[model samples]
Target: MSRRWSLRGKEIAVDDEDVVPAGLPERLFATDRFPCERINMYSTIDFLLCVRDALNGTEEMAMLLRSCFGTLFRFPVRRVLMGKVIHGMLTRQVLTKKKYELWPVFGGNPFRFSLVEFGEVTGLPCDEFEEGYSIDYELPATEENYAYWERLIGPDRDATIADLVAMVLGDTGMPASRKLRLCLIIIVDGVLVPTSQIQKPSLKHVNLVKNIKNFLAFQWGRESFAWAIRTMKPCPKKLRQKTLRILGFPLALQLVAFELIPHMQG
Candidate 1:
């Protein structure tokens, strides 16, 4: 009689005399879900399996990626979609980390998974994206497509827009609230866009300059950018850098949405 425990969400067992139904593969052991929960353990593959299971029976991932990404839209499609996707993917993993740090915003390479994978899977026309990092891609407008998208995205677009902005900002060095404000500015100030230009990109839609700017003004007061800056506090160097890459680099996206040429000086 030996006490057994599960490991890494996998249904295997540990400790002395941990045998299964006696006739199974000698290499495998059995641990029931109740016991596993009692011991608090799981396998990495088990975790992935769970994710796979959750995503079963539908192509939501592909559809969301395609809808939010693909051709440029008048709203920030990638921004919104990326947040939801990352939130779904990372919340579980984040809970598992023994040592976790929660900043006002979450910033790191972890949030970039969907974008990186999307491009690889779609075989999209990313010609303009080759020369720069994730933040430098652009989204060109198409009037007919834009109108179709507007009708398709519908009224909830604003809520979705806010989510993406928050996620990206959180993934950056800025505070969650500030990330919201700053992202809004970048959207309207003509800094953010969804283009294939980034070495790896997350956003698949673009924002309108007037809409973004006006959104910023309403969201952040007259000194919105400056006010958002005030909220910045110190984080560890490693975390800070990660945040900047996730949040700051995407500032290049603003240029695309606005259709501005980066090299030209006013």
Candidate 2:
């Protein structure tokens, strides 16, 4: 049934089905969408899911994966720890090894990667592998992603995470994704020198139900924070130590004990 008339300003309503509700955060992203690659909340896992779904010919699953980004892209910051983790993941992406060097299908220009210098074998027998390798990059903007990120963030710089959380929670009119990207940039660069990390108090309102570290530890389980720290930037010793502790020194020790101690002759 058709509505009698659509109200000009008030007719539009929130789609009850969508995860993110209609709100100011929606308006913010609507103003200017993120230009570069935007990862799903599950990120690499989401990419794997898309690839898996595509393999299974489940088009709708790809759509579902596309829709699963973290809610921080909307209004106030909710999952602070998740936000930080995402920021770390994005930062890791920021400094990715140039893949085009290995796979010419990226199509920008020929370049060499220090890690895998195979020289110019453009017309050689080895070029067959490039075709197989290119299959792994079926998604759009596969390598251009690195270029877009390179432009958005510079090496040895700080991302705007704290300010972003502050803005989203405050009365600011900035896009949440943009804020998160800025934070990612800082996190990517934050390793060089530790700026004041996000204020824990500000995030207290977000996940009050669980202890943040415990929750993250449950998720990270056996992984060490060293990887995050290395990507975020090397900091002062105290800051590094603090990061290690926050990232999960106890869990790390447990992993080491379980895997290493059992094997040691001592």
Candidate 3:
């Protein structure tokens, strides 16, 4: 049996055979000094800084490219696929309902752009689900369609999205959570449409991953802080202050805590 990481209560086997030198994963995530513990904070800040510097002409495209490579270092390709499926559904479902109107919300805004990106996420045409729903056989599957679909679906879509959304929402069966977050992130950040969307092998997939990583990291920190500030009702009088002081409060962390604690309490 291989060592594995348990994600959303599922055991995913680790392919690498290298033996850990005892307590590595725990130490990496648990310790303050270990890079993984604070990697999100610094990496997120650095990712933003790189973009800023690029826009300011202080950093050239070559330098930004190098930074981008480093920023994505060790990012789980599987997670990206999961996110793609979650967003893909939101896009396809809404588009099917109304070709011109973006569902979950109607606006010519950044959130709306995310729905448009659904096509890129699944590597299927925006009309796939609609065609399926209508039982239309007008669209033929080309070699490119098969290839892209293979890449997008990988092992599965619905199953993977189910797990990923559960992790993000702390819900047993909340289908709307991931889509809601994607819309909120786009609206809050007001991300511009990438020029690469027009090119072959569109950048929508690439940027989608980056956007999700940033949004999750930021939310994690935010929620952590909110958890600290909000007092627990019916707490022990003797330990109330101490409990508040020790909370790992950050804004991102608060959002995560809000999502998780309800499930935990239940």
Candidate 4:
């Protein structure tokens, strides 16, 4: 016999022997519960697009970026759809020990997204790489790293995403190589694996891109997928807050949803 269950007012049929996951909530949050006024999700699409435009007519610089970023530089930004998918996934989230799962509101089987899927969807490199290349791997605090940070940012304070955008867009007479490095950092810290600090570009990212070849070889897909998973993990304090701030790459999640759920394209 099958039993009907209501989750946030949506009814679905379940087997009599089916049991809810141990840590899952009895009632999922309503799909409409996300408040537009309170949610602060940031995107760097405009900044990146402007940078792309600025590089127009410069064949050499453009080719360099294409070689490094692949399709990530061309990732389309659909703000509305991204928000909807992110909210839906968060509301319907199912927590597990290893990874997180999302139960589609449209009544499909729960699914888990991993680095492999992320790489497939984004066309980023996902192969195993050296530990030093990993996003989470902190570089040693050396004078060279400090000098690089100072050259890009400043001597006094940490630079924010807004600051990077200005430098990339403005004609500060920066070299093509330096600008290219900055652009990659903007993509990673500003868009792909953003944190709650208003998408502040990490100094580590700045250091990683110093060697353009090595930076391009890094497994960005794996690191980004891991960051996104970490961001979506259940948090009691976050759930209680009125202003919800989501970290990581919600845009990637939206893209994956479009591929997996064909109906979402409509």
Candidate 5:
């Protein structure tokens, strides 16, 4: 028997023969170092909390973040379980050609983690963009782009995640617009679509945020979800004996676990 599954607007047939056993024992044995290191959202959440406190008695905070990142602003920061999230990553099985679905065994039962589940859990945008719409394409790389980059990172070097955090927390003298831009940078780089090299922030993201309105309207959920799936793609042979670094927002996975598993809600 075959079942029809819809993922990210595409439909496919999943046959019983095609549903392979997780075969996790063999994969786990092949890799001695399955320690998963993922980018945490704590710093971003903390910064937002601080911003909230600072904007008490005013609607500026809402005006700044609500329109663009309403879902993220409402994210249950305290409920994230890193241990459970890492366990899910370690046992994840890539079961589809689209690579957007993961089936991870927990307590001897498999749970589905797919784009649809991720969007539902995190409230992130998951609709496929219309043709010719690109999320990663930044404004033209000109003097204007460099000027914004310089303002954020300075003229001498690329800005690291540490640098962005420092700006978000310490750079109080900056104008509200600049400060909002900086916060967006940190949130996107530090929490949403981070790479293993957590220090080096992407200039593409910086340039994209140059126009705040466009940045806010862009479908970040789709981009972030795609990055997470790409990072989670299994490559046991190449990753043997080395730490596995997970990219994208792992907090979503933790939240999903909390919802699906009763005991984990605590």
Candidate 6:
């Protein structure tokens, strides 16, 4: 049977019950429950299906998210109506590789997801972010969204985010994680900023940035994103002449959420 549930204002028709089905897809259909999850699984399997070593057959990645991403929410999974549109699930502590909150009181980027630690949280100001990056109020405020997303990933259970992620995505070799880290390299020229000090970008980062729009356009495979990237050239100038483009916070958050699948496959 099909049922309609309004998830964060978007009307979604869920098939069968809300239980995230037990396995990755043999093939994709219109009725997949977790839309983004379904597509990611499909893409991963489809792209790397033939390569045996590339994937961890029985212990696949999504399976890991299912097993390790425990139920922190109090309500029964079945009892819940619309799934909470977690605003900063990517930026929240549990999702972080470091397993703790480093939120800046001055309102940091709530969606900044990384395999390891955040560059820095809020309140403590840094010169690098103020000079280098820019903020997009475009991504919705995550304060209200945090209630539903509270401890969704269980940050404190004595497992490294990488280990659990490897357990979840079944990436025993951990290639994707490495690739993700590489992509996350901020290309700043001659600034000599220490890796230890990172800051929140307010739409303009100093030194340099990544060609995030182009990267995201390829990753999401959405025309709208490509259109927006092509049409919008908000921050054009960079300190260095040879850099590609600046990576935006929103896309960086997405990279954390999706991990290195797109980087590996695409």
Better candidate number, 1 or 4, judged by TM-score:
4
**Candidates arranged by lDDT, highest first:** 4, 5, 1, 3, 2, 6
Better of 1 and 5 by TM-score: 5
- Summarize candidate 5's per-residue lDDT along 162-248 as a digit string, tens digits: 676666567667667776776677667776777645445667888878888777776678878777766566555533424455667
* Model 2 weakest 10-residue run by lDDT: 116-125
- Which has the greatest TM-score? 4
lDDT of 3 by residue, 185-206 (tens): 2222221111111111122232
When sorted by TM-score, best at the front, the candidate numbers are 4, 5, 6, 1, 2, 3
In model 3, the Cα lDDT at residue 220 comes to 25
Q: What is the lDDT of residue 103 in candidate 3?
A: 21
lDDT by residue (81-146, candidate 2, tens digit) is 332333232222212232221111012221112111211110101122323332112234334433
Name the lDDT value of residue 13 in candidate 2: 35
* Candidate 1 lDDT (Cα, 0 to 1): 0.26
lDDT for position 210 in model 6? 31
Clashes of each: 24, 9, 22, 0, 0, 21
Clashes of 2: 9
Candidate 2 residue spans exceeding 4 A from truth: 1-160, 180-266
> Which lDDT tens digits does candidate 4 get at residues 150-205?
87666734678777778877865878777777777877888767765577767677
Q: How accurate is candidate 2 locally (lDDT)?
A: 0.25
C-alpha lDDT of residue 153 in model 4: 66
| Global lDDT of model 5 | 0.62
> What's the CA RMSD for each of the models?
21.4, 25.5, 24.1, 7.4, 5.3, 21.5
